[model samples]
Target chain A: MNKYILSKKLYRNELATFYSFLIGFLIALAVGSLILFIQEKNPFDVFSLMLKLSIGSVNSLSNSLNKAIPLILAGLGISIINSVKLWNIGAEGQIFMGAIALNFVYINTSINNSQIYILLLLVSGFLGGAFCIFFPAITKVLFGVNEIITTLLTNYIVFGLTIYLINGAWKDPASLNFPAAAYVSESVYLPTVLGKLSSGFLICILFTLIAYYIKDKSVFGYEMRIAGGSELTAIYAGISAKQKAFFAMLIGGGFAGLAGAIELLSQTHRVSTGISQGFGYTAIIVAAITGMRPIGIFLVGCLFGALTIGGSVIQTIGVSSYIAEIIQATTLFGALVAQFFFSYEILKKDEND
Target chain B: MIDVQLMGLLNATLQAATLLFIAALGELITEKSGILNLGVEGMISVGAVSGFITAINTESLFLAVIVGVLSASAFSSIHAFVTVVLKQDQTVSGLILTILGLSLSSLIGKPYVGKKLEVKLESLIDIAEPSNIFQVLLSQNLIFYIAILLMIFTAYILKKTMFGRRIEAIGEDLKSADSMGLKIAKTQFIATCVGGAFAGLSGVYLTLSYVPYWTDGMTSGRGWIALALVIFGGWKPYRTAFGALLFGFLEALGPRLQTYGFEMSPYIVKITPYIITILVLVFLTIIKNGNTGAPKNIGIPFFRENR
Candidate 1:
């Protein structure tokens, strides 16, 4: 337990971490470069432009922050689940369920039920995400089917459902044959405190803190990680793998649900086919880049959000946003490979030396 | 509703089932040998695009499928390299491969958009040609038959063949299998590649006949659904076919419900398959006591040295 002795014994391999990140960036750049060349554009300009657009001006910064909000929450959702060693690839489906829940509260409320609507929105959003995720939780606990495939398959089916809704039940009466829904009441809307800045950004931060607290401080969090580290040992220690997996899935789903609520209440004010468009999916990259840690998740989440915002700017600059996606994916690849060094110690034998 | 139309429905079901069946069969083999290729979806997408581009440019469906399977196998080799050879996480590598495949396919497929394709299909056999039931059940695209053939072959290889026993043995315990002179790396490598090859064929079916046109993400969610169906079928050959048909019926049923005059909302109906998957999966779990009926080391990446 001696601090100095322990410090010397604990080996941290900086080289591995550095190389992993470097390797990721290189591979990502190579992959993205293929896209860039296909677009008949210079890869250097696209990469440089992407950086500029993401962090260029005050206005640009605001847009990036707004987009990053949902990603941060969704990414943490991924991290939280990973910490428990359960793969919840259905964040996309959970978000859809969350957005739908938020949308329901938005569209069903009477004009007078504004305050009530806000409360209902939060509750419904949580339910939407948790409910979508609950299906996979049951399967993992009961059938022992890998949640990875089940969850992803469910995500697809959920998209079909979303498409059905917009084209059917939730079609905006006022719109001219567009698959959209009626705008939520103004009173139910989440406010924008900064100019053109979304309030959902705050929601993202709040969730991150909650995740950090739950993972780092709570006994359950410690047990969850222990379970992930070794399921057999955890079981021997009297931890229920089923319970751990179930709760992990639920929390992940719930975070995605809240993200949906924030989107419905703050941004579009309605659900459309565009309600998805890969925000939930991109959260995976954020989660991985952060090394599945909460605070680290915040930084990486914002970075990815900035990529989207900046990618959008490139579209305006006559470069396709497709480049942005390539960059984002590549960066994730780069970041994930790089972060490994931080997690493991590299050992060399004297014989080798 | 389930009477005379069973044949035509059967045929369409066969076609649809064949697409996923091919890939699922491959997935089954690999899983049996104890390496989970989570990149099935990505590999399928890549195969679809590779087949579409090559076949469309050449106007030969057979060549297209070959390219599709080869390309898919090649793409899958990357996954095998990482998880099997390099000892990376099977799930993560599979996912990364998926992401990479999707992005790469989308990027590569962009140029082929809005173009018409021409493929040469063989003349139908005269016996099944006359009867609707026969036509639906017996006559299908060659690939459909190929898929069935692969399934039977897989069953035979796994249950009756020595190689199959070795695969099962490896799946049960890698160390024991290796100690018994099993070529662990070669068997795993071949199994993963072959599994990937069928997944590629499934993609080719998508581009050649199902949609018969090239579009981005045209496989939709079929890859993942097929993967799920493989599990729901309890990883058995006969059951896999039944499961695929069941899934095919539900998927087709979504559109068939449109014929009703009530004007059902798409959202509620669209969720049918997903909801059913959850319900059935949960039910199966409760019935089986949360133990997987799957290969023991299904998702654990393989390394011979470690064993």
Candidate 2:
């Protein structure tokens, strides 16, 4: 009889981690297939159809790329703070705050030029998102409040505030009670790369490079890593962990805010409660899957972008669109589970330690 | 001058608080066992959808509640495996469970949208007779009474029972408890399952007794609110119940204030409860240390030295 034992790996293996990620995604797809089968549709055809809709054609690919822009930016934002051991769950609220800022400028100003107006709106968005997390970061450092709960609570507040503005104060008289702010002027719209793709996609790539440089090469990143790795060590070395936390969170919030601004200026053309489309929450999963690496965030962000577009595609094929969410969530869960295998091994009985 | 209408509002507050208290009390126990399960919202969504689907088919509330508890517990067992057995990070694992729970619930609940259950449990109050303050207080559904009993029972067990002491010991110092020969993993796993069950019950109550229909994302942020209440209560079961009631009164206050003909946006009114929760948390943090009333080893996964 053959015997097998599971034991801990002596060292971390990158190859194992990579394989586990693929296997995790495969498992998630299998689960998703079961959901499709339950709905009496062919899972293979649906998957292929999803692929076609998201990346198989120029038009659909452009739409998917547009969606990936915000996700990539938001994922990058989450990655920054996550590296610092601070979970900034307020990205959703920050995105909304950014939209609010963008709309404030759009409504209150007549900067109808393409070049200057877009730049101002983008800056305001960054500032708006940064302001949202400023209080939580300061409170976390000063009062020792858990940023998790505070950030989450802030999301609900922003959700309610957004709804209020859309339904009341910011409701465009031209929208005719549709509960949406007025669309931005045509010149304010983001320029297209191709026919339908927005310039926001290029900005996403640029931000990814910038985030990579900040995370890997910069002094602030070095200090953040040391502080996140060990507060005691950081304190002993005279690093102000509090300051790093504050700045890291601010940058994180700013990236997500930028996503919100791009979403408004490029795709939606107006502010609404659904501008985020839960990207803030989904970005967490993307950041985690990528191990908080900037480039990994971009690729995974696009995958999720495809998943979401596929979800809407499934809706037209008689399967519930939420199947996309199931797959997205399951993939993350499976990845976490697969991580266990990379770190440890299963052993048969009577195997010597 | 408080009128009968105001008494009715307070009465509604009690009912709302009952659901929060039930979930918070269960979470209090889980935290006492040193596991922080942030997937309370996800568990409730699954429980609510499963319970409503079962009730619609069986026309039996008891069976539906059982199904709710079982499915939610079953779902949380995945969390138990990840956090307890694998010794993974609790926050990430809990968040994953929440995403899965919400997605799965929405997918399954897609069919049941806009469909009403046949056996909805209305208020326990009989409307045939004239109402008074006492009647208004007692008019809540069966779950309200059960929540009160559960609170007292949980408080007693945690304070007096040997099992509770062992779990509390585990929460405070897992290494010491393990050295003392206590089964840390088993106790924490059971506590998590029980917590998941209670969250499920809260969902069933919401669907069966309160809303009487399944709605996607209907649990909303209530599970998160329950998590906040557990902390606001300082980890004491009875105190947590009080916190839940206070939160409920604050939530109930929003709609009541609108009745006075104020020009406030209803959406702004909806945000008051969340804002108040934040204020209370900030106040508590200022008055006491972050670790005050919290288990020392909460959120850390425990690993045994050897098999």
What's the i-RMS of each model? 4.3, 1.5
Task: Give the C-alpha lDDT of model 1.
Answer: 0.75
Q: Candidate 2 residues B162-185, lDDT tens each? A: 999998999999999989999888
lDDT string for model 1 (A90-174, tens) is 8888888898887776666654676676777877997898888887787677567668867787787778777777766887878
Distance from true position, residue B9, model 2, in Å?
1.5
Best by lDDT, which number?
2
- Return the DockQ of model 2: 0.69
Q: Which stretches of candidate 1 lie over 4 Å from their true place?
A: A1-19, A110-120, A142-145, A227-241, A316-320, A331-353, B1-4, B120-123, B126-130, B257-269, B303-307
Model 2, residue A71: distance off in Å is 1.5
Off by over 4 Å in 2: A1-7, A347-353, B125-132
Relative to the true structure, candidate 1 reaches a TM of 0.89
lDDT of 2 by residue, A1-353 (tens): 42754466678787665666687799899999988887888999999999988888888888888888878898898889987898877788888889888999778887646699899999899888888888788888888887888888888998888888887888888877467887888888889998689999999999999999889899999999998899899999899998898899999999999999999989888998768888888887788777888998898888889889988986886878888878877887788788887887766767454
lDDT of 1 by residue, B59-161 (tens): 8777888899999999888767665655556777677677777877876788798777777444245344324665565556678777778878888988999
Give the clashing residue pairs of candidate 2, or none: A4-A348, A5-A347, A5-A348, A6-A345, A6-A346, A6-A347
